[model samples]
Target chain A: MPHDSAGHTPIDMPDDPDARIIRALKALLIGRGFFSADDVRRKIEELQSPAPARGAALVAAAWSDPAFRAHLLADGKVAAAERGVPVLEAGLIVVENTPSLHNLITCTLCSCYPRSLLGQPPPWYTSKAYRARSVRDPRGVLAELGWTPPRGIAIRVHDSTADMRYLVLPRRPDGTEGWPEGDLARLVTRDSMIGVAPALSPSAVGRDPSGI
Target chain B: MDRLRFAIGQRVRIRDLPVPGHMRTPRYVRGRTGEVTQYCGSFRNPETLAYGGNGMPTRGLYRVRLRQGDLWSGYRGSGQDTLEIEIYEHWLAEVGKGAPDAP
Candidate 1:
């Protein structure tokens, strides 16, 4: 029940312990001048600003330029920076999917995702069932998510158990040859970047020409 | 910053030690064997960091690849299926170097 320096407790504070702790810490940090209230607000804004488009842009560039693809696969943070995407994760790894291999990402311990590139993780990504089953039965989870790799193609699951955040560079769908990078980016959905689904097929993109 | 105990491609086993506090090592992989696929660089020990420790002399973090069949008794996927997890150096011990205390 300790009041902040203002001598007033947050009237709207929830009864939840975690939320209370967070609020208390925020007040202490601000009081100590670790960071101003505006800094926290701006950080929240930055985190919520970029959607999947940031990741899609990188995927499209990799699909279009072989050299850029090499750089992306080698150092994703640098690649993202080159394209104006700021990766705030400790490390960013871009895993590639191929004809014989498919990659799936899940944080078995917690929802450790490439948030800076792809925005906040989807609810399913943070669900307990997903955190458990994705490592135990990735193929089954992928199937439930509406994607199943072809027979003989292996599924490799990445468990974000530590500091590194993963972004799956799903294979570019066929029939996208000679397409502009922007149009190609339009086909890269958030699910594809998470490796739960493939990029939108050329025909599917054609169906939603406006992508509305 | 001492020499990393494990190297890429070296086989190691996750220590099955029961840690009481915050730890990044997952339970399922404990006592399981895997190959170090990549040396993900040194990082502050999260177990200590979680408790507000300085976590100095960072430990190495590695991407270890384990066979799905090896992890789960009834794994349904092909033998080629694998799971890659980031494991801290302290949580892993060299396979066959000295057997881990029996579970």
Candidate 2:
């Protein structure tokens, strides 16, 4: 295998425009005083390490503990930081789902997600179609996403338009009495925390080989 | 004392005025009436923050709710359904209170 200057085998990229552009940009930035290679690598590593699991753990903890829930509701940024979840400088506002109101999140202008907590956003979330329809019709969008709240419950859509980030504090499902926090965390999915769907229910959590 | 003009539960309308550069308020809710849900504290204006200028002028942030029927034409959802947006103080005005003026 022929290795490039970095001594790593060159990956397949005959016509990848972005790959070339990114490589050139990195070289230019490092050549100039804009950013060092280490800085870029550090940022990529940090982003890759963080995922929805962190948010799920927080939600699970909140479900079991009242005091932590109170603190989280009082000040989301502080609570997440206190629990060691690197609260991004961009403010995070946690909204709780209640029997009366259901919350839906969408970024109408752009694809600004809670990357600091959730590892990555699905492609559909950032698409223009979802961005437009979510604001125009939230209930229709929710049903398509497999989130069907009991009839007569109101849906509230939150458009993250600015520097602020939001995390949905999904209501705990019933019949989960005394479930261990670790097990409960499994019930939470990335989309559930994003308010696109409700947290996984006990009835739907079937045993798998990996014990999801 | 906080410099906020509207209190929680107050009925207000999102202004129809166009904003320069970037804006947090979506177009669908413009000129629509809604109730203030909660105060999200004062923060540097994002419109200015996006540009190179210093985002010095802080504005009160809020979570406002509007009925789904009010925004969408021929809406099928129950009248109880509502949509909430995080809007700045400058983009809202007191409505249904004696010829309310724009902010």
Which sections of candidate 2 miss by over 4 Å?
A: A1-25, A207-212, B96-103
* Interface RMSD for each predicted structure: 0.7, 1.5
Docking level of model 1:
medium
Please provide TM-scores, in order, for all candidate models, with all chains considered together: 0.87, 0.85
Model 1, runs deviating above 4 Å: A1-17, A20-39, A207-212, B99-103
lDDT of 1 at B89: 84
Cα lDDT of model 1 by residue, A1-212, tens digit: 97567966657747698998999999999999999999999999987877999999999999999999999999888888989988987699999999999999999777898988888999999999998999888889988988778769999999988889888998988777778899999899999999999899887866433333
Question: If candidate 2 were superposed on the true structure by all CA atoms, what would the RMSD be?
Answer: 5.2
What is the lDDT, from 0 to 100, of the residue A183 in candidate 1?
Answer: 94
Residue pairs clashing, model 1: none
Clashes of 1: 0
Best by lDDT: 1
lDDT tens digits, residue span B1-103, model 1: 5577888899999987777778888889998999999888899988778888988868899899999999999998889999999998888899987755442
